[model samples]
Target: MRFRKTGAPISFIIPSGNLGNGVAALWTKKMGLPIQQVHFAHNANHAVVDYLNSGDYEPSDTISTLANAMDVGAPSNVERLKALYPDFSLLKRDVAATSVNDASIQNAIRKSEKHWGQIICPHTATAATVREQIGESTNEWVLVSTAHPAKFETIVEPLIGKPVEVPAPLKAILLNPSQSQNISPNLLELLDALSGPKV
Candidate 1:
């Protein structure tokens, strides 16, 4: 859609954890879209950046960050990426990756609100931070906004110094009771939760 609108090859700086979104962009490029580069913007959890830069796939423990959605140490799609681009050099050429810490995420949020009057979520801020790092370029860069700012009020409100206004549709959804549940990563715990209360 952005390609059609811009009428030129565009590069995407996507905030990724599992690398699903980044892989999707790569597929788009494979399909012959006018995509120049598919850059990944990672938060504090930087397994992807480390792997891409070093050509060594070493996944460590997950590190929590303001960009909670992207707190993935072990990206599930990396194997797919490796399969798609077997050569490390080709993979590096096809994709660009970088990591931004919590401080940068906060700064991105504050700067966006202050300078552009755009209230972006922490996940989006990671991509925004990367875009700042990349600076101005002839190639059009699209920083993917993963979620609405209002969805992350706890993190974003304090940074931007104001409450993010929830969109009408999101507000309506929020008014409904949440059906989410918290459980450990253990399969037994998941099975128990799915099985419901004991008689």
Candidate 2:
């Protein structure tokens, strides 16, 4: 909201899942910036396999993959998205929804490492795949790298054929976190917290 208020064009590219949808509404309604929602072909686990086989194989209709963070079978954000963008054509013009399988994501990771020598997490890999599919346009596209590669070192290291380095900021978390909360994946519970009385 602040970004849009400051006259900056904000574009949010999100994975296909309820998580992405929740915030997307707030941004569009409150900020009036464009939002592009992208759907990944593979779930968390099989993202690598899907990316590897992307060229010849079509995206699977079944929603199964490894990347657990993004394993959303039915994204609940669709209604809000429709409400936000009433004109379908305009939505299509400004907002884009592309599906990139796991193969493409892995390819992007490898390419980014080989070409740019940067280690990006799976979320960033998905963003890169979408950016490539969108082609090079005059629009200044900024991809939000959601997490540090080290977050998924187990999956990323072997693929890159090297150990991924942890950024200085994230190293602290790796060292020791005070506590972690395990909450039920219930939207109502989340909304209740968000809508609770202000302190």
Candidate 3:
């Protein structure tokens, strides 16, 4: 989580799920950069469309794509992001947003496998689409690989036409004993846990 900028505009694209909120918070805390959280109405096709059409931010020609996890229609942490960076106008000037569709994602997977021989998960594919949109002349742009590709073995295997190998560390998660604790999605319930006595 080192926040090194290679003198290029940085944009963080997050999936619309529980994890997206945490990712935004971590980046805001770690990088101390203003984040533009893309919020999609549940029925909206593209989360970044309105933001782009407003003429507030210029869109990049190079957009990126990721698979299943990238299927986020509405991100939940946009207000947190704005609050973290009060100087919103300056922040909007440097950062832009876009999302890749399923078709584009599959094409990207085929293209990358053909060109680089590397298999990236759908989320990574989304980031790659953005990077490519930015063009080759841009500096080092980092894409967050949220999880291992092996997690989606069935889909990825068919795309690459081979079995994907699981990293040694991740293999442990598959082997080890684990437990799950279910919690209600209500904010008040979550707050009660935080306000409760230490475990």
Clashes per candidate, residues 3 or more apart or on different chains: 0, 15, 10
Per residue, candidate 1 scores C-alpha lDDT tens digits across 50-116 of 9887889999899999999899999999999998888888888879999999999999999999999
Task: List where candidate 1 sits over 4 angstroms from the true fold.
Answer: 1-7, 179-199
Candidate 2 achieves a global lDDT of 0.58
Candidate 2 scores a C-alpha RMSD against the true structure in Å of 8.4
Cα RMSDs, all models: 3.9, 8.4, 7.5
Model 3: per-residue Cα lDDT over 73-180, one tens digit each: 344444454455457564354445655566665666667787999887765666566567657643334455566778877767788888989999888888998864
- What Cα-based lDDT does every candidate model obtain? 0.91, 0.58, 0.53
Top model by lDDT, which number? 1
Clashes of 3: 10
- Using all chains and alpha carbons, the TM-scores for the candidates as numbered come to 0.86, 0.63, 0.62
1-199 in candidate 2: lDDT tens per residue?
Answer: 6545665444555554344543453355357455333233233433223322342212233465434466654444545555665665654455554556677767888888989898887767877877777776645556767677888888788778999988787887768858644558999777766676567
Determine the C-alpha RMSD for candidate 1 after optimal superposition of all C-alphas: 3.9
Candidate 1 minimal-lDDT segment of 10 residues? 1-10
Q: Give the lDDT of residue 166 in candidate 1.
A: 85
After superposition, which runs of candidate 2 have C-alpha atoms over 4 Å from their true positions?
A: 1-12, 19-62, 175-199
